[model samples]
Target chain A: MKAVKVILVLFLLSILVIGQSYAGTIKIGAVLAVTGPASFLGAPEAKTLEMLVAEANSKGGIKGNKLELIVKDTGGNPEKAISFAKQLIEEDKVFAIVGPSTSGETMKIKNIAEEAKTILLSCAAAEVIVNPMAKYVFKTPQNDSFAVIKIFEQMKKMGISKVGVVSSNTGFGKAGKEQIEKLAKDHGITILLSEVYDKAASDLTAEVTKLKANNVQAVINWSIEPAQAIVLKNAKQIGLNVPMFQSHGFGNIGYVKAAGPAAEGVIFPAGRLLVAETLADNNPQKGVLLQYKKDYEAKFKEEVSTFGGHGYDAFIILKAAIEKAGADKEKVRDAIEGIKNLVGTAGIFNFSDKDHNGLDINAFEMLTVKDGKFIVLK
Target chain B: MNTQLFFQYFVAGVTYGAIYAIVAIGFNIIYNTTGIINFAQGEFVMLGAMTAVTLNNFIPLPVAIILAVIITIIIGALIEILFIRWLVSPSVLRMIIITIGLSIVIREVALHIWGDGIYALPYFTGTALKTLSVGGVFISPQILWVLGICSITVIILNLYFKYTLMGRKMRACASNRSAARLCGINAKNMVTLSFMLSAGIGAIAGCIVSPITYVQYDSGTPLAIKGFTVAIFGGLGNSMAAVVAGLILGILESFSIWLMPTAFKDVISISILLFILFVKPSGIFGNKEALNLKEF
Candidate 1:
């Protein structure tokens, strides 16, 4: 009887010690598409988060407390994302959740995060993720509308009033198409022809010919698929010599290589990360962008993509919020909204109650493919 | 549409048609001998192109293509020997399932090896931007290469089947397996030879078209579906009819984009396939009596 009582007392004391140590750590949950079709987005995002967390932990973590990150790979499935979001909220009880890489998965769990009052900083590009403005749901990627506005603003400078839009039938392409149509008229532009082609289309000659028939001043191809590279090649083959505009999806150097010589002189709007070396030395984002690009390339032995930048932006934003709020979920949510002029790889973010994405048209830089490489459009 | 635009669409249709016809010929070669669809036919094409692209890094383009086709032919022979040789007259459904399973295995293995990156070979005559213009119509030189190689492949295959002793033995096995075995011919070896022949042709087609269509790990399935449609429309075992059927389907699909949205292009082609199946089960050129004699 005396040994049993002593054992019980010692077990209680050990539990107290373990529980006390865990109390100072901030637990963050991330659901990303690490293996499926969207792995292009999620793989880099996951790597960036893992690198940043390790760096932070080595530096004594945020505000003298260690950070515990839990990453869940959804393989770009919304159903898995829903289950993971619920599990992270109810079971793991993480203070905050960072991503569900693609826009579809992010939208699937937006309400769950809102109801649970856990902060969700999504790395998706869809405007719908934040336009409704759930108090607890914020996003890191720049809005599709901002990208569209930047493209239109450049078109206006070139005196191009009529354009043809071709997009793939994917969520990213469809969302970009809607934004382009919605903002074209506001920018004094007229869309002569709009077509949605299959994402797996082997040839896009017929579609490009239709744009030629319409006599549009410029052609805008909106897709993240290899079909977009086909579009560039087909348009050049048919001798449609007008300027071509691609979506931010053309940021990958692989696409330029796939299109080969045809990719030259093609323009697109993208984040500053692609042109990080060309930015002025004193620019606020230059240092952050270069540091991230250098660190990511060195660590992964691969080129740094903007998709990873989205994940990087989410972490830094969350770090700033946690620094100010100090592990209080409600306070972190408010602190995120109150963050202003935070330098990130995507852009300088200024969050407010009315806006959760916090990026403007200026966030996009008009980039062109020149000599088979991305350069700032002069 | 203007005459130039009409011609432009026509050229596009013919380019894709030649590709489909080649793949359909691959299907017919296997279906003729084994009575199996060999759904992994498309993977042969993918394998050929991917191998050539990798080999092109260390060797000249023409030599790389030849080596890739030979490699794919060996793989085809191995697949038949390992998977189909000991089946002892397997049911048609069983063969179909096995081929489908094999295709998935090959695709996954390719995904692992290649890492899902889209790759294309350099154009043979000129760069991607170079085009030959006749009147107001612009023609990509790569399209001409696709058409010429397809025609040459079909001609060479026809000659081989007509004049070669080995080809005659394979045909005998295809016509009457038991009788051919009694006549001192190895019917099983003929099946392996048919697989190699089909794989070789598929690889040739894959290499010529990779410059225009681009090659990826998963690009094979869609090509396979289109090729299967052409095969069915042309009569399952008739290679010559496949050429006509492929062109008709391709031209119709391209023109359908003019009347409807581009998203419905595949819908129009597949609907034609359904209509053909419902109206004439033996296909446009298939003899009803001959189809009745064969086992599906």
Candidate 2:
């Protein structure tokens, strides 16, 4: 009886010691699409978060507390994201959740995080994620509206008022169409033609040919993946010679390469990561962007995409929030809202009650494909 | 619409349709011999396109194309020998489920090997296949290549099946497997040959379309669906019907975009297909007698 009591007392003491040590660590939850069709988005994001956490912990972490990042793969599915968000908030008791890589998944889990009263710093680009003032949610990527506005600004500078829009039938495409339609008139632009194609359509020649017939000055395509690249190739094939602009979805160099020579002179709006080297010395995002680019490339042996940049900014913003507010969820939420002038790979973030993204049209840089690579359009 | 607009739409439809037709022909080959719709037909197309793009870095384009086709043929044959041959007694339902499962496996394996980046092959002629402007309608040379290759493939297949001894044995197995086996023809060997032939054709189709569409690991299913639709419309195992049906589907899909919103393209095509099936239960060119036979 005496030996049994002694062993139980020692086990309790060990539990107390382990618990005390882990109590000082901050836990951040991430839901990324690491293996699904959107693995392109999730793979880089997971890498970015892992790298940032390791780097911070190596340097003694934020405010001298060790950082623990728990990443879950959603495989780009919304149901998976919601379940993961619940696990992070209810079971793991993370102070904050950083991502559910795609916009659709982020929206699906927004209420969960809000109910849990934990901050969600999403890496996805949809405007709906941040608009309407979701108190507990913030995002790093420039909103789709900002991407549209940036494209329009470039169009205005070139004196191209009449434009044609070819958007995909998917959520991203449909949302982009709405933004373009809503903002075009405000920008003194007239949409000559607007059409939505199947995201999986093998060819868009008919659509391009129709746009050319309508005599639009420029064409804007909004979608992800092969659709964006295929439109450019189809335009070249059917001789739609006007300037073509794509949404931020065209950020990846792989798309540019896929379009081959057809990608030349086609412009799009994207984050600063693609043009990190070309950013001027005084640019706010330059230093951090360069460091991230070098570190990521060195470790992964692949070029850094803006999707990864979004992940990097998520942790960066969270680190700042944690530094100011400690590990309290409510305080972290307020800290995240209070963050301002935080230079990140996406842009300088300035959060407020009215704005969660804290980014405007300026967050995007107008980039054009030149010689199978992205070049900043001066 | 003006002549130029019509021509532009026509060219677009034909180009797109030709890809479907080639895939349809591939389906016809396997379906004719085994009475099974090789659901992995599209994977063969994807594999061919992916392999060619991968090989182009090391070898010349022409050599890469040939090698890619050969590789697909070998893969098809291997699939037959290893998986399909082991089926206790092949039923259409069982064969279909197996092919579907195989397709998923192939796509996942492809993802692991190549990653998920979209890849495109260069235009075969070195430069962007110059768009030939005829009276105001622009047509890409790639379109011509697609149409040309598709037609040649159909003609060569027809000639081979009609003339070659090995092809005859395969046809004999298709018409009556038991009789062919009784006559000392190896029905299983003929099935294997048919798979190889279909895979080769599907691979070539992939190579032809890759420059325009850009091939991804997941591209096979859509291509397969489109191809299956074309095959059904043309009468399942009829080569000539496949070509005509492919052209018709492609042109209609293109022209419909002008008449209605782009979203209705699939709706319009599938509706037309349904209407045709409603009118003639045995597709446009499919022989009812052949379809009635359980073996073929």
Q: After superposition, how far is residue B250 of candidate 1 from its true place, in Å?
A: 1.6
What's the C-alpha lDDT at position A29 in model 1?
A: 96
What local lDDT score does residue A358 receive in model 2, on the 0 to 100 scale? 82
lDDT of 2 by residue, B153-176 (tens): 889988888999988888888888
Per-residue lDDT of model 1, residues A105-146, tens digit only: 999999999999999999999989998889999998888888
Q: Candidate 1 residues B1-296, lDDT tens each? A: 88999988887787678778888999988888877798999999899999999999999999999999999999999999999888998888998999999888888788778856788889999999899999888889998888787777778777777799887787777777888999989999999999999999888878988888888887888788899999999988888888889888888877777667788888888898998899987789988887786778
Model 2 CAPRI quality:
medium
Best by DockQ: 2
For model 1, the docking class works out as medium
The list of candidate 1 runs beyond 4 A from truth reads A1-21, B81-89, B162-165, B168-191, B293-295
TM-score quality measure for candidate 2: 0.95
TM-score result, candidate 1: 0.93
Which window of 10 residues has the lowest lDDT sum in candidate 1 chain A?
A16-25
